[model samples]
Target: MTNEELEFNNDEEVLTLYDNEGNEVLYRKLLQFYHPEFKKEYLILAEESNFSDEDGDIELIPMISTDDEEGQLLPVETDEEWDMIEEIVNTQMDEPEE
Candidate 1:
């Protein structure tokens, strides 16, 4: 789906993606934050019906970029980067939202 087609409900954002079998699946944006060191925005998403942390707060991180003609989502690489991102997310979640 195109960036302009993104839909938001309440405070969560929705993105449509295709599975290996090319079936459409919906994912919800849980959190979005910029990495100071990387200077890139990242999205934390959870798959449909898998939104709770009851089992575990499983999330996907995709680097967000608009420099391309269309928006781009890239996978996060390196354990160090993932660790930093997680730390940032945790820190932000602990604070009150304005």
Candidate 2:
């Protein structure tokens, strides 16, 4: 899909990838779903490609320029932060009667 056709749902932190036929192929959360290597490759592609519009807003592009090196760095959320998030999710899930 072309850069213009891509969209980012920042509220959900999801990257919605589309097929050549304009069908949704994948939905991945930026913080929760993607592998570190894939994220790195995405970053490299974004760095190398020239965007037609530069209006200071972020855009999602489905195509990856594969000539670039793959990125392999994982996110660095601390254990405490992860634990807190886990606790929050668990608490929400465990909530019972009103």
Per-residue lDDT of candidate 1, residues 54-95 (tens digit)? 977666544554357656677788787788766766665666
Candidate 2 Cα errors over 4 Å, as ranges: 1-76
lDDT of 2 by residue, 1-98 (tens): 22233232223333444456997544333222222323312211122122234774323322322333652233334565345334433443355635
- Clash count in backbone of candidate 2: 0
Give the 10-residue window scoring lowest on summed lDDT in candidate 1. 1-10
Quote the positional error of residue 35 for candidate 2 in Å.
24
For all predicted structures, in order, the TM-scores are 0.67, 0.26
The TM-score obtained by model 1 is: 0.67
lDDT of 1 at 59: 62
Pairs with steric clashes in candidate 1: none
Model 1 lDDT at residue 6: 31
> Which candidate number would show the highest TM-score if scored against the true structure?
1
